[model samples]
Target: MRPPVRLALAAAAASALQIPLQPPNGANVQPVLVESDALADRVGAGNLQKRAEALYEIAELSVDEYGHPTRVIGSRGHLGTINYIKSTLDGLGGYYNLSDQIFSAVSGSVYQAKLVIGDVVPSFTTMGLTPATENKEPVHGDLVLVGDLGCKSSDYPDTAMGSILLIRRGECSFGQKSELAGQAGAVAAVVVNSEQDEIHGTLGAPSPNHVATFGLSGATGGGFIEKLESGEVLDAIAYMDADVDIIETMNIVAQTTHGDPDNCVMLGGHSDSVTEGPGINDDGSGSLSVLEVAVQLSHYKVNNCVRFGWWSGEEEGLLGSNYYVASLSEEENAKLRLFMDYDMMASPNFAYQVYDATDAANPVGSEKLRDLYTAWYEDHGLNYSLIPFDGRSDYDGFIRHGIPAGGIATGAEGVKTEAEEDMFGGRAGEWYDPCYHQLCDDLHNVNLTAWEVNTKASTFALSPFALSTTRSTANAGWV
Candidate 1:
């Protein structure tokens, strides 16, 4: 947390009597639905027609061809992206509320990696180069092989300590296996795809500093397993470098204001991506699209406030956004009337999915937002349905705080269907976003129609919820 955070938190709590925390299960809440056409005019062909420049800016970030700013911990890309996000937020031309959330500890770097085998596959899976041992000297041992060596104690299966572990992937995260292998006393591990075909996957739980691990093809894993099952001892040369220390990361925040100095609206997106792939659709689409909305909202200030956030270390864990939420006092949290999080808005699979946000009988803000999204889809005659909140985005923070939170995404990891394209008119099988975490996600990959459509939806999502009054957050008494 930063000084401003502590000071603002103190101020938000000053003389404010503590209120009992409302449990989501018990709260008898009502939906504050903003069903209005206030933004319809601005959204139509006319105003949208004139905002080409702004649209272009948003496209540059969200579209796949231009390449997104993806940076990992302990990397130049990470630092560059941090600066880029900050600069973009500053460019929105407002009183920027920025802060840094440093990590609990710095993970050492991975150095000197080697695989002793015939033709080591170039592509592999491992948690992001976690701190590893660069043991240059080759260690000879009996090769113990297994399939999907998960964290379950049963996974050990009489495996020899300090021996190599050759396993295929499935039923667990890559990180789970790495941490589990480390605990199992395996000096090194060789993980291959469960199938011969390589399907990109998450290596492990988000961790900047974890372990030295890698992935392989089934053929490669099979070769090792065969040697092990045949009772043949194995020896391989491996090298790795691990650097442990403090690594710097940050959060990017921009705000637009309107009514009630005590209460405000929130919007957020993550600004980080994994290595190798620039996460244009994963979150770049969400972040920049919302950034553009923040810019437009700032230009035409409303009664309620808008705080646009670009969270860091999101790919590593909900680190940046969680830190911000953690610093908020209950009073400050109460003042948060609404939170709108946009993650992967232009998904490779661009279904108009409504998030499950509302249930009037026991209304939560997110539930309310979900209701709003569903209504919007119905009213617009769009094919969509709300999915459950699956702890896969930045909204996790606000939802946990009992604030009303909701947002949108195109799709990722999931495939697009022919019917979807027939309706939305895109390629089938290819997701709404094909280059989600791959290098292919550039400016060329964006759907122009989706861009315009989402922009219109965002106008509705943000504006009506706030008083449609004029600019000047101070006049509205909002901060």
Candidate 2:
């Protein structure tokens, strides 16, 4: 789902600016010495807040006529955001080596979606990347229930041919269910949520084998199931008009010009957003934090190479980071001392959550990375919690490659528990970011306290590593 962004500037401009028009190899760098605390002191809360507000303004200007302030990958908004970051780095006067890693991916959005069950028009959200209805018109068919969760091919009935398949959500991804429904000859697939509300999802990627897939609310879908159980045969109409295209985008990677390339410290945040809103809080917080740190670090020097990445296609499925990691050779991978990720650093109702790398999925030096954040928070008199090191963000790509990885998150759609409320002073029983992935995730979506604290914490944690990985006890053969 994560793809590339369009390069706003021409190759001539890049050449004129002395920017690396190609992907970076952390070459021609010089290392300087810097203290962790001194660098941390430069990451002012006011500075971060200022940049965040500017980001929101940029997002607003990028809004389409449809009223969506979307910085979704390959969109004009996203390209503008990338240009902003690149320009910021360029203004830093070549203190870092900058490069754009370009790649192609299918970006999609639903322009229109409609579902009518018999005489009733029910609410629905179209799954991204699902094929449009034939001619983008409503396809009328009998709604046939595909028994079970519709994970297996056998779960679909032969009667589903040319009909819309009503499948329950569970046991598999929406894409898997849609693919199976297509193979069974269903014209469209409606995946009903097992949970309460209507859901928004993706087919994961562009698929020729997918029909128009839509998600219906649990109440609406359950009502249909009950009517069917009562011997009612339903005729349904499904329509979807979507825009799906394979577009080229770029990942911005910058490393300190003077550092030990053989042993480097890296950090990253996704630069793209979902189709719904500007994603100011969801990631603008994180991306700007990295940018701020990278900018501030230009004032100092580092012993070990320090690289910052503003990844694209993360919202799609960590595509940018995955591609970047896969592009690395084994020796290059080994040269990476560790990677720290900053994702939603400023959720409205935030929790100071660090990546818990105790799980087997964690690489050799992950625990050390986790401890660094933990210690940093404690030292700052802030409460902290541990989130699983799952492949939910860009860190997954590096962790899977046996590189030590850790990061912080300010919670997403997940609800804030009473314990978290007690620790972070946010309301319990509410999502950490209520506006997450919505059109309202704009300038007001951030908790300034969470934004400031997390940004400072990130600076504290990364500064030491930038100096040298040997400062930590968990070195464990990391070269």
Candidate 3:
């Protein structure tokens, strides 16, 4: 069993004072319902900001001795975050059936990754699930330039055997490239970035067929390509020091005790950050928005059950939510009426992007969820665009089970287009969140206007469902 987390008095005080709790409407009496506007009015931007600021402080205090402001799964920063959330829920004083859903996940870290070609040593990032070098020693091999991206088995040359294969990123996943390289008897694989910047990504998941793989910057890769084109033999060394271990983490699932448990409305956001930063904007904005709404809703009564989940290990690929969904019994799964995800709600270069479940990857009832947010934005006189339900966030697991899922994201990583800029009023060329997954994703990374608007929009969509499932035809298409 995992150890219990202690509640902080400060968090308890904050929760109690931030919003007034209403007297419990007995389960026997027909529950009173609040309108979307009224519920949204109670969600304060200042309160959300306060929670975010506190989370930043917690993240700083929980950093490792090396001073990385991370709240990654199994890290102290994440533990602090979990405690704060649990304490806040506890302060709500029996309003919710709070649970600490515990699960184990593999946590990984790369201490160093470097690519040496003769006299030149260039920086590189290790791909996820890459095995560590023996005693931190470099792996030396003759560099063989594999024509094409090395995504296909035919792309690997005979020279790639007993040497390090150089492949470019694109056409397929890193795992596929690495697997292909290993199959070709390559000692190691170096996936050069197709873009200008260095590639910082994962190999999706662990595969025994994968050899050691590293992602290289385009400039460094281009220099090697030039050498190869000039018919120069390039002896290379790929060095990496990394470790992966199973770590225990918890997800907070809080449900109101006053409504019909058979028909449940679910909303959530990730509560953990990448190893590089505090992640105030990436998910702190979304998590806190849901938290603030949960707190405020304690003052009202709901006809249907409302569950708010604060998921951990999202930065590591939605581990917490996936485990939760996978662990659910058939009956429990049936009770979930709909799920709404709020992730990265306050990107600096924000767009009012609602999940486009109407198109590809659409789960049953997802279209209705999409229309709900679309209508809300239209009613509020706000511009909104459609973001594909790409299975990129915590919603993926829910959708995979054929559950109705929809949500909003301001933006992340993807560059803002001219059309998006004109619609949302931000610089077109820059990324939606420039500090995304970097050390700079601290407290100031959030756009307060975007945060507040998205938060209110989330409340507006959720309030109607809380009253009753009559507004949502989510069950019509459920298999």
In terms of TM-score, which candidate is strongest?
A: 2
Query: Which 10-residue span in candidate 2 carries the lowest summed lDDT?
Result: 18-27
Q: Of the pair 1 and 2, which is ahead by TM-score?
A: 2
The ten-residue window of minimal lDDT in model 3 covers 1-10
Kindly list the per-residue Cα lDDT of model 3 for residues 44-78, writing each as its tens digit: 67777778878887777545432677676666667
Best by the lDDT measure: 2
Q: What is the C-alpha lDDT of each candidate?
A: 0.55, 0.81, 0.79
What is the total number of backbone clashes in candidate 1?
42
Q: Model 1 — TM-score against the truth?
A: 0.70
Candidate 1, position 66, lDDT: 19
Q: What lDDT, from 0 to 1, does candidate 3 have?
A: 0.79
What's the best-to-worst order under TM-score? 2, 3, 1
* Superposition error at 306 for model 3 (Å): 0.9
Please, what are the lDDT tens digits per residue for candidate 2 over residues 10-117? Answer: 332233332222212222232446767776777776777777766665565445433667788866667767877887887777788899899987787777789998
Alpha-carbon RMSD, candidate 1: 11.0
